[model samples]
Target: MNKRLLWLLFSILFMAGCSVLSSTDPEFSRENYDSWYDKGEYQKALNHVNERLETYPEDALLWNEKGYILISMEQYNEALQPLEKAIELNAELDSAYNNKALAYNETGEYEQAIVAAQKAIDLSEEEPEQFINMGNALSFLERDEKALEYFNKALAIDANAPYAQYGKGVSLYFLGKYEEGIPYFENYLHSYPNDIDALWYLVYSYDTLGDYMETIPYLNQIIDNQKENPINTVDYKGLMLTYAGELEEATTIYDGIIEQYPNEAIGYYGKGVLQIQQGQTDNGLQSLEQAVALDNSLKETAYNDPLLSSVYNDELFKRIVE
Candidate 1:
């Protein structure tokens, strides 16, 4: 009887010890999962989370962390399950809701994202980042006016909010208030000189306002910063050819581009403009025809092209535009 009792006691003690060890373990599974996440091995991180969930099913923080990892991977649909579970476990987990909204936004579910973002904003109180995120969600929903309001709110909370200022500029640009947009873009550039999107918008705004001269310096800066960025070089060349009146230099650059990218429509279009500017009618018409055949998208601007304006009444020009 004593032998049996001793064995039973040993078994009970062993089981108790195992339970304590498991409970006191530093969540090594979560640590491994995070390591995978930091390495950009998102699928591996998610698999680790699933394994941990089997052992710690009631861990709300683990579920929310998993949701954040899934959102980073752009696995938006898959992210919803864990995030919803997190919200169910702890209604006050603001980051879970914020991550859920990000996932919704990634999946193009803008309305749902807006609802989720609003919840996050309520939880965040006066946080500027939350307001900026809310503005982004509103922008995706085509509620530009409301988006601008949120952007302004974000700026009020944090005057140097880059995302908010950039959002405001984009909204204003879409609303056709280019003049209002320009200052915001300029402000963003003052702090973020390497912002390619802002630089592109600044160039576009100046071009639209017939202040092409002002755009040249920024384009030059972009080219200097990014040596291999072909788009900036091409845009700069086109703008210089149009407004700078350096036909000979423009011709040389366009010819080089055409030789490098024979099938590219922009190079042909550029060359055609250069030819027309030099009074080479037949060559210009041929180059323009090649450009149109390569990509008909250039047709809209062909008529309004300053170089082609001189030949507006020409029969060949009419045929090409038609």
Candidate 2:
């Protein structure tokens, strides 16, 4: 009877060890969460976080990580809860306040974003990114002068900071110092050659300065880069085509984009601009009307675009405005 009991106890211990190996490995779960987040599967990442949190509820960094994923998913209100929870657990978690500021910015709570960003800056170990975040939040508040100060502060900390350079460029651009803005953008692009935001702003600054010829190289670079990542290519291509008087090519590109993404309003708006540039008034009006109907954001620029000047006096254009 004693021998039989000893064998049974050994078997039970073996089974318990296997069960522990299968379920409670923290490294495996952390890696799984990272993979999901990288693939933009935020909900899956959150589920993983939930499982992990069951075991490590006091982990402030994990809560901050979860908050960032929620912010990326644009679940701003939902993100605030986790971010606030993280801050409550650890007031020194700079990333938590930084992510919370982003969420607040997305929700149009500019003042809240400013406060959060300031808190993040105060808590941050690394000064440059924190200053950049504060500058961005201030920009959203239309405190351009204050924003410029923080951007300059960031640049003072690290002149090589691409984000700080970009922020300074934007602040200068909005302050009507286009010439001053151009060099900062160029400096940023020097370090981050594939930065689309820097490329786009360089084109805008060149256009504003009426150096349209200088704009061509950056625009071509953007188009070429799009072969690898096609997010902003259509806009860059359309601008170049418009300036080069290659309306037919521009129209083709815009049509192809619209076919692939019918709900995207920019393609329709671009097609309208190209049509109006070619003196096809009625078709251009129809495209612009469709664009404005699909997305009101396009309406803000409809009247100001030079390509649409031909149809500006039309009844349809008046109706669109009304």
Candidate 3:
């Protein structure tokens, strides 16, 4: 062959090789989706997995990955079929069943989640997550004692498992053993300090045990962290004044709560009561107005609260709460 013709042939071969090595190509053999998935960039991961699935539709691992991603996205109903298909393709794939359990759990199908989690436990290579899934399902079904067994099993497998600790704590909590639940909750919180759910669980447990002072700090943390908190901060203020008698500390906590969650009425309501107790009459009244402006329900609260008796007839207070 002529030199020019040989060079053109080499260029064509190299271009074809590079084309075949792209990430989407089934023959390319890269774990590209893992990076996206691990980084919590699910959409990018899904797109990448979908590209591979287009070429290798029967791949069990890819289908399982797809199902898990959908679950993580909270599309539980959508995740089911892919997970089922993964199981169909590879009956022994324990992780697929585990993923299915999580999806079913989210959909409130506790019985089905238990069934899938059991299969995962049977097939998994002693994975603590499998037991934790089983425990969560049982707990959701209100069978906390039975859930405790599974959570303990998970703990047996991995002593430092955060999910297992949380599960054990929740089971103990539902069983009315608040004191026993405390340590496990603390253990879980050690791993996930910002988890609102765990923090709330700890607060409720402390409140039930009459550990009013202990509840205050967690309540403050929840108010600062939770965007749509369901907790009644006004009631928390009452607990602070009535049970804790740490008015100064409570006032400072409420101040931080107000600063951290400026738009929430509860924080302002809490701070208002604290200010009134300290005899900052004008500041207290202003806080009350702000509270009622944010949530009209606080008006009724302010009017009924004993702590506001002296201010009940104050014109600004009457206009604010009444």
Candidate 4:
């Protein structure tokens, strides 16, 4: 799975409609605040909250709302002040604790996140979201077994919670229970059909399990969605295609990559390995030599690649790789 995608998903649950605009803001009503937030105008919403707090400095809800807006803007560090202030004003404000946990998690303060999330859960045990948040925090600390336990706890409270499903799937996958992880992700996709993070991991789990055929459709989806960053997926798709026995298609992909980036040794190395595996020894050896000449570091990888095994005993192959 994509590491960026996991980081993004881990801290995403807290921003789901946690706005708390006051009905009594005569100068800036809740309707106006809601409109700005609903239309993705987080900056405007943040400004409105700041303006409101100028008059009502004691409003815990406004503090929470400001923190939520800052979070939407990806300003996790800026979000903490208002969130802590919210908790300071109202000690029982579970949402404030939950949002603080999210901010802390995003900033790589996993220990703080765990403490805040547990506080939120203590205040509102019935709220499944706090459990999910706590699980995500634990997962970030590489305590996946503990994360799975909290995820299951959240699922018991709200069986259809999408984040809980996603967290459970991630924890299970990391724990080497790939088959068990599949249903959790599949169930989440039923509700969130276009979740690329989940789809990417589904592809990864299947690929790791040697179910190359099962990974094809999701791989195609990722490839199509990644057109703007073709470099990220092109070589990976080539390797996956090779694994699935679509050698001709894989070679075509390598050819396109080599043409697009002639100086890059990876394209040549991949092409050489695939060619050698396909019985084109002479052409493959030449390609490998060019690859090694361009980037000598590739010699170590080329030496170990199983695709070059056919020529393992051949002195010509040994010399080029060495």
Candidate 5:
């Protein structure tokens, strides 16, 4: 699935505080199950649901709950079974259809996701989730204009809908209306100030407009977040700095990356590009040679980039890329 969907799932699972769902039996309580689910105890929640299902075998709600928990755990394939069962047991379960759409979307079954979301919308036109789901499916299918329409429909129903706001921004960005997409991402960031997804779009939109300086704050936010979780390897901050003509700051970032990850070729590549752009042809060529030696895959990129044109016909540059 796309990063948009992943961000939505994380927001739902973490931000939607433990609200208890209605249960048929007093014995099959939500208290214990909700506590487990809220604490990221998927296995415990699954066990509880399995035990309850034995006594309440026909409970469509229980099956749906199980499916929802499974989706939260990212067990999309496993989630389908319970969600499908919930629909079979009670065809009118609109929420079950929505959950099913979520599972299908996660698995890249966009057509099935659209069908399930349409079913949910048919069952309950008042809910914004169905529209958001449909929009997300359309976005993934590259029907960005159609996706924007659904997102607008959801926004008409609830102006403050975070998913709708985020969807509108994403759809507009995908449609190449990057300038128009900025406000929607800003609105989303108002609700979720530190959300990496919204910040990423802000960075991208500004960068696309050739206003790389405008991307700094958002890039800093992402850089700060990466400190908390370092799996992110992309040097967006450095790239933005280079684009904005902040060569010193960009070089510092590249230097840090090389110090931290000595063998990674991208750091050297970025440093080389920056150096060449700043007219240090000899030093840049040396760095580029080191980068190519580490990873020859970047040779084509280095050869074609306009910023390196000054040395395009240079003997050393030709040797490095060729």
Candidate 6:
């Protein structure tokens, strides 16, 4: 009776310790892969997967997972090998086909992406991602009508699928259906609010439609989200404000640009044009001279600009530009 009780106690303790043991030993647990991956420790996740593969090289799931890890690392070329290997090991591995399509898409091999995505779609049901992959590749190939069909298939599967909406938007945008594309981008932004590409699409659509004022707010949003200096975006906003007749606001933008980037020829060039338009010709001429000194090309631009026509005959302006 005592021996039986001890055996039961030992079994209970061993089962209890198993999870803790597996959490440490990468060789003993698959959960560690997800633990590292879920935390965005992609290199650690890759290392863990690679370490396990050294022993269980035939493991198809691990091979597929390794491919996914490489994709997450943006190592698209490296991802293809393991993804192919996974499919070789298990012909029915739908996930491997999907991942292979994604890697091919990033590498600019659109035909291969479409082929792999087709395979994934055939192997799985209700998977919008594969449809999106095919749509993206077809769109890249200038097969907009065909691509639209696939995007529509994805949308039919999930009406609110953001990626499908984005893909459809891209097709329509390229096809000159800017007005129709607007709703799809808007739908996509509903899910991915700050998506830079979608925001730029909206900007272009509004600009192309001659709705200049509509573009200003979106441009401002893009400028605000820029991680780098955003000097170009700031210039765009300043130009847009000028077009909107918000002269004071535009002047402030130019001043800010000059202060932030003192050596930038564009800031001085923009400031000089605004100054000329606002009848600050003397100050404008000086700024234009400085701009021409920094970038000789702006001399030709100043000569051609209608805003400086009033000062065209000015001796100082002729000395600065002509």
Top lDDT hit: 4
Which of 1 and 4 is the better model by lDDT? 4
For residue 197, give model 4's deviation from the true position in Å.
3.4
Model 4, 1-322: lDDT tens digits are 3443474554754443233434244565556766886798988898888888999888888888788789878899999999999889888788889888888888888899899989888887776788888888888888999999999999999899888898999999989999999999999988877777888888888989988778777767777776476664677778878888889988998999899999988789889878987999888888988989899998888788776778887787889877
Where is model 2 poorest over a 10-residue stretch in terms of lDDT?
10-19
Evaluated at residue 120, the lDDT of candidate 5 is 84
Candidate 5 lDDT at 307 equals 72
Q: In model 2, where do residues sit more than 4 Å from their true spots?
A: 1-44, 225-322
Expressed as tens digits, the lDDT of each residue in 262-282 for candidate 1 is 888888888887788888988
* lDDT per residue (tens digit) for residues 1-322 in model 6: 1211111111100000001111122464556756775688989888878887888888777788788788877788998999899889887778788888787877788899899989888888567778887887787788988989999998998899888898888888878898999999899889878766778788878877867678787888888887988998788777767666777988999999999899998899888888888889899889999989999998888888877889999999898876
Q: What is the C-alpha RMSD of each candidate to the true structure, in Å?
A: 14.9, 15.7, 14.5, 2.8, 3.7, 13.7
**C-alpha local distance difference test of each model:** 0.71, 0.72, 0.74, 0.82, 0.81, 0.78
Question: Between candidates 1 and 6, which one is better according to TM-score?
Answer: 6
What is the Cα-based lDDT of residue 149 in candidate 1? 92
Better of 4 and 5 by TM-score: 4
Ranking of all candidate structures by their TM-score, best first: 4, 5, 6, 1, 3, 2
Residues forming the 10-long window of minimal summed lDDT in candidate 4: 16-25
Q: Candidate 6: where is the Cα deviation over 4 Å?
A: 1-35, 51-56, 279-286, 299-322
- Each candidate structure's TM-score, on Cα atoms with residue i matched to residue i, is 0.74, 0.59, 0.70, 0.88, 0.84, 0.78
Runs of candidate 4 exceeding 4 Å displacement:
1-5, 8-10, 16-34, 190-196
**Candidate 3 Cα outliers beyond 4 Å, as residue runs:** 1-31, 228-238, 248-322
Candidate 1 Cα outliers beyond 4 Å, as residue runs? 1-55, 186-196, 216-236, 244-249, 289-306, 319-322
Assess candidate 1 and give its TM-score to the true structure: 0.74
Error of 4 at 20 (Å): 11
- Candidate 5 structure quality by residue, lDDT tens digits, 98-180: 88777787788989989998988888877678888888888888888999999999899889888789889999888889999
